[model samples]
Target: MLPPILRLLATPLPLPLVQGMAQASLTHILREHPGLFDRLGTFAARPIAISPTDAPFDFTLVLARRSVRVTRRGATPPAYATRICGPIVLLLALAEGRLDGDAEFFGRHISIEGDMETALALRNAAESIPLDFVRDLAPPWRWAQRPGQAVLGAVRRSLLEREGVPCN
Candidate 1:
């Protein structure tokens, strides 16, 4: 279970606040990792876009908030756009080199729309970066698992263990 303070922190905030945080976080990550953008030419021959969609889990995340729309053809660095329910989750995954373009992240609620090849290439480049360096930048809520899950789990167990006293 999460601490009360952490639970409060996980609550969705305003869109503007989320967008501001996303933009600042993206800028910080890009600035700290110069080689990340420099290596884009290796992946995308054409520009690619990624768009993320917010879901029940994290409402404030603005999908595709940090995107590079125009990029050179045959560029080593890949371009991408993403729509994620949690910007911090996406950022942390990117920084940690754990992003899988073909994985079921979207099916699980992390959406990405773009050129498959370019997206894969970008994923490769992002994976090359040292993830640990960006660990401190991860959002506070990420520090613990979501509280709702625990509550739901308890409810499920209670329902399963109770004796059947009535018919529907």
Candidate 2:
């Protein structure tokens, strides 16, 4: 049976509300880690976009004055330098070091565009962070991944069947 009506996040939440919460979370993490910014120092003023190939929204992270910030300008600046795109699950795994970056890249599951320096800086930062920060993200992600993909396929089939559309 379909789940009963429940909504954890109402639609049309104010953009600032989400951004502010994200900023706060990052700020809290930085306060705990204390040296992450130094790892990201190379891209201090530059914008680096993180895109999930399956997700509609993308955001850029910028470090300024030793603080990390997220922005959704949606406009790609030449200065934006590095952009990474991958399925949501794999991307999260990549950040968490649960999977090899090279395997994901060569498997064609992830793609990188633009400046190598910014990519390197981001890579180093992801590697330097204590696993506890990202370890929490992977288990739930890995657990739900297969079932989630199946559900998406089922949704597509159900919609197409209703529309008299044949999907081969």
Candidate 3:
């Protein structure tokens, strides 16, 4: 569970800011890996909601259209074919292929609801790509890579520490 202070602070954030951040991040990922959603096969058209159980909002990914929509947790959400609910860190780890989805699922670290096929397709598709979000978000400059990755790594380590996960 996330700290109460974080939930409190995030709960009242402007919707546009949250949605815009999601869009920008999605744009970067798609730019870095074109045709990334094409590997979802028949599940590409299905909307998937990624809910960070410890967060104040959920992200509904419309992979078919290459966009994401953020919805406040307590508000009514649009229809989604599948929902993957977990801690934000675990979700990121899954997308980055740093964590085994099957093991986490079986270990009860994450929960999947709705269409199982869509979830499985997503897992397989994500696993096929090596996503380094830190590098992907950094400016495409040779000199920026190292410092950018270092800063991002430090931020991630702090977040992990806050979640009581040991940093290597």
Candidate 4:
């Protein structure tokens, strides 16, 4: 289970509020470091749409103007598809040259749709940005914060425990 604080943070907020927050955050980052996303170039103009299949959950992230749609379904080839969740994370990892791309992290459980090549291209483009620098762009309450690491660790432990696997 997620901690109360995290649950609150992740709670569904009004769409306007969510959009405002995202825009504000992005704007801040861009203003603070104009070159941060320069490498992204056209990719930043693209939009990535994420939707949870079999559910009403859906969102979109416009990168450089390209649109990549991601969706989650009970049974599908690309189970969890979203540029934010999959491509973004993967790109970040790749950019840092730490791309484990572990099946455990993004397994058959998630799927990618539309412009697989573009997604791959974005991954290559992200190579210019350092992961640490990217992490530095978020706010304190952001998931990139230390608390988020703790939460991820707890979740990993819980998953391992449930699977009867010893967690380190």
lDDT of 4 by residue, 1-168 (tens): 223454355445555565565566555545554554566566565555544332322456565432223222332323222343333333333334554333424654235566665555545554444434334444467555776666656664564454343455
In candidate 2, residue 12 scores what lDDT? 40
Query: What is the TM-score of each predicted model, taking all chains together?
Result: 0.44, 0.61, 0.86, 0.47
The candidate with the higher lDDT, 1 or 4, is 4
Residue-wise C-alpha lDDT for candidate 2, range 2-119, written one tens digit per residue: 1112112322455577567666655556566666668878575677777765543465667554333344435343346688887655665566565678877888878999887888
- lDDT comparing candidate 2 with the true structure: 0.59
Q: List the residue pairs that clash in candidate 2.
A: none
> What does candidate 1's lDDT look like per residue over 47-166, in tens digits?
443332222122122122333332122323342333222233343344465445345365453445544555555666677766443242444365443454455445433432332211
Where's the lowest-lDDT run of ten residues in candidate 2? Answer: 1-10
What's the number of clashes in each of the models?
A: 21, 0, 0, 23
Every model's Cα RMSD, please? 12.7, 10.0, 2.5, 7.7
**Which prediction has the highest lDDT against the true structure?**
3
Summarize candidate 3's per-residue lDDT along 40-60 as a digit string, tens digits: 977988999999998989999
The lDDT per prediction is 0.43, 0.59, 0.84, 0.46
Best prediction by TM-score? 3
TM-score of 3: 0.86
Task: For model 3, state the Cα shift of residue 61 in Å.
Answer: 0.6
